[model samples]
Target chain A: MSSPDSSLAEQAKAGDLEAMNQLVAEHHAAITRLLWRFARSHADLEDLVQETFLRMVRGLPAWRPQQPFAHWLQRIATNTGRDYFRRNRIRDRWQAPLPSADDAATATQPEAVEPGGDPAARAAAEEVKHLLARLAPDDAALLTLHHLEGWSLVDIAAQYGWTVTATKLRAWRARRQLRALYLSVTPS
Target chain B: MNTPPDPGDSRWDDLLARARKDQPAPLDLAALQRSVSLEARRLASARRAEAPDWTALLPFRSLVSSCLAGTCAFTLIASWQVWQWWQVMPWAQWVVASSGGAP
Candidate 1:
């Protein structure tokens, strides 16, 4: 028996607009949560989520029902995040703002933090984002998956289509880079 | 200023733990669905616009069929003319006569 998702996917592939909408509705929240880790702001999160679903719709014809739909969507979401990091890397190089003395004070303001969230955790999240922003985009994505998301190296390698050995090497290098960046910015 | 913790210390782990605790607010699913639907429609329309229209080639296709028919008719007429010329040749008559008037 085919799964409901598989049936929906087949319908969507056959150009059933209702099935397409249903598929997006079912997966939208999960995609949003997955992309939230990569977005710097709510708007960026929305954009990433939209792009991921758009890509899913475009690639529906190529998706096989044998593969789980959720896993396929997650792969698309991860790739969307990676692409966001790459675009931001280029934009930041040319348009990054100069550091202001009041930046530290502003970073912790209530308006700047998530509502009903711990300030310390929010600060830590900001720090993680800062450090990740400095590394290569792909490295940032790999480390984000391995560390923040608690994904295994093997799982990440599979998601990225990299060999296990290559994933291990990359994880090591990204960790080293993060440590160095953390040390440099820390008060001595 | 507080001294930074060493990379090997528990502080790094603590930081990662705190960072992991951060969660995004619940998204507006209805809004997202609308946007995705809109974008999907736009992409579909774009793809349709870019696809080659076989119907648009109907005139050219008809022109090609006519050219092919004309070429076949010309070839048959030319072959018949060549056969008529060959029948009137002295060598053609000599061959028929040599073969017991089998022309």
Candidate 2:
């Protein structure tokens, strides 16, 4: 992810606004999705996304080429999202309504109808989202980065400044906890 | 005999596929570009104007402030202690000191 195009990076580092915009344009969608997944609501998501870019712009001059730029960017975004959640925890305390009977029914339905659209698959996604939503924000962020984002364990380790073993262990523990929670709440 | 499928593996694979497929439509890149460029200009201007002298001054400021605070606190305590000692000391000491220790 290190744009070995030294010219581009040099320009970006030198505060070339076009270069900076280009870099953001390349990864902004993924960053937005990642932040939205971590945030509790759209407004929080938007704020975190903006803050992430602000931090990136501020910290760009200090960035090292040895690091994968995308991973660093994601780490900043994750931390910014985490910080926003921490600061706004009280404000977000309005409990979301539990899944209704119909929602559960829809989830449990089989996916045999659409030859391409996997209903069971869709159900699993919905289940994962629901289960993740119930967990702590940090746990959800960790899970999304590792599991949903499909980042390698090493990449996650570097992103979070954790050892590979620690990342793996935490991911394992989070999955186990999530499984227990999912089963207890929505007995399959 | 039909082999039983691994439920956990199947579930996670399905979920991953869904996440990958569920990307929202791409944003308006032109609009993003415009806004990002505008922001970049504003930031660059601000950076030039402020030069972020605060970071350069931070350590010195912190050291001076801490030293001043500590000195003030110590001075207050010392002055209070001296005033207390003088208050408790006998009047004989004051009379002798008044005669420059001759009396």
Which numbered prediction scores highest in TM-score against the true structure? 1
Cα error, candidate 2, residue A55 (Å):
2.3
TM-score of each: 0.81, 0.60
Candidate 1 lDDT, tens digit per residue, B35-77?
7678668877887976456557566779899999999999999
| Tens-place lDDT digits, model 2, residues A1-188 | 44643445567778798788877787788788787555543445556677787788778878877777787787898788666655554444655555554465355443344222445444455556556665566666677666666667677677668887777777777777776655465445
Residue A86's C-alpha lDDT in candidate 1?
96
lDDT of 2 at A52: 80
**Candidate 1 residue-wise lDDT, A42-127, digit = tens:** 77787898889888888998999899988999999999999999999989788976333335334433345355366777677767
Rate residue A48 of model 2 by lDDT: 68
Model 2: runs farther than 4 Å from truth? A1-6, A33-48, A84-90, A94-126, B1-13, B51-103
